[model samples]
Target: MASRCIVLLVAVLLSSLLVVSSSASSSPCTFPAIFNFGDSNSDTGGMAAAFATVSEPNGETFFGEPAGRYCDGRLVIDFIAQTVGLPFLSAYLDSVGTNFSHGANFATAGSTIRRQNTTFFQTGYSPFSLDAQSWQFAQFKSRSQLAYKKGVSYKDQLPPEEYFSQALYTFDIGQNDLTSGYVSNMTTEEVKQTIPDILNKFTDVIKSVYGLGGRYFWIHNTGPFGCLPYVLDRYPLRAPEVDSVGCGAPFNEVAQLFNAELNETVAQLREAFPRAVFTYVDVYTVKYSLISHAEKNGKTHQC
Candidate 1:
């Protein structure tokens, strides 16, 4: 549950925004500041320990130890940052001052859009929820402005004004609401009904950043939840016919439907703000590619 995800988006070369096949890759994204929003796939340290439970094996492999990321190696966000020559950022909760120099990761593990509210309970630390993350962005903007007034330079020496001007955002989420093992009681229809509200929450989150001057973003359509280990644990020996990729039918159908509605919603957002770039990454296809061909990623193919 702690493997929260995050994504990094930058000025998409509109010409290159088209989704490509596995043979080729996307062009280098150009962006200044990066803000991530999502569940375990992109969360850096937020899943590591912002809450009371243990943050285990979240950032292993490439980092060698916990850097708070949920996956084994650098996620897409890290790859994009590296592509643009930026240092790996720190989670917002890290007291380390260097995290402020580049970008800050606001993703929280086991969190959702409009799900958790920021609060302090004596039992454990409550990480920033989507609403809380937006508010924190406001504070970040103010502090950055102050830094500008004093002439403190960013890591690349870009002015705070330019920092945000070149900023980009990414979001890879929405699976947790339906797939968390604890929520097995929820029917597929119940999950589908929640899509509209999820999109609404996402709109609110995006607008909050827009208010803070974010003009470019990449939102991922939901992934095939039926392929995850937890899902397979529930329904092994699944029909390969229901899933061309052998994941499953029920979960993929929900993800596909959610992605369809999300695309329409993104089109609406694009229409409203023509100047802003809103791109949707194909989490569905990407995961399919990875799962169907795990050898490409050097992992054991499994249920």
Candidate 2:
């Protein structure tokens, strides 16, 4: 899942954020910093900072220690930073050894676009919803500037005032909103009914960030979570409900519907904010294709 997501996001981001011109120029765009807001997909260490340290095996393959990421190595956001010649973003919630000179990440594992009613202990969802993240960014912006003025020692730890406008604001979220509906025992149709409100909340955050001098936006539509083991194991599906790739078809269908509406939402946002550059990347298709082509390991057994 991690590798496939990396491939899709990196490919799309490279074309949109890295490509210089149509005439084969290799120069990447000069994005001074990256202000990211999303879930575990792009979370560097927000979850660990807010809750507890992410233990071994999570970052052993990359940093040789738990680096706050849920994956074994780098995330799509990490690649985005490297591609743009910026350092990995520090989590806003982490106070240990952080550098916000480049940018700060507001994402957390188990985060949802819309605020969840349940607690983290109850539903495994982060309370730092998209709205909360936007608020954090706002606070970070104001506080960092004040801190940056203190002395020369603070200059390298905080971003320049202009970096907020020059930075790339990336988003990869909303999948948990769909699953949260399911986890709460809502029907597929009922879950589908909530997408508009969820996206409205998403739009509100984007608008909020834009109002705060963010000009560039990179949004990723949710992927096919039905194909994941968590869903398949937790929610039993009949043989007829399963697709050729063994994913829950009903859930994938809902995801598709959500993506379709999300695409329209981005278009509407583009129209609503003319000056803000919005690049919506479709990760659902890439994820589903990769799942379909994936092979089973030797340990597989049929029920």
Which candidate gets the maximum TM-score versus the true structure?
2
**Residue 2 lDDT in model 2?**
18
TM-scores of the candidates are 0.78, 0.90
Off by over 4 Å in 1: 2-29, 52-60, 116-127, 150-159, 180-184, 234-245, 295-303
Q: lDDT value for candidate 1?
A: 0.62
- What RMSD, rounded to one decimal, does every model reach? 5.6, 4.0
**lDDT tens readout by residue for model 2, 1-303:** 111243433454445543442125354477889999989988899999998788877876668888998876778788778877888999999998998889999999989988888899888899999999999999999888887777667678888999999888999998899998999999999999999999999989988999999998888888888887888989999999998889899999999999999999999998999987788787787666656765632221110
123 Cα displacement, candidate 1 (Å): 15
In model 2, how many backbone clashes occur? Answer: 0
Task: For each of the candidates, give the backbone clash count.
Answer: 13, 0
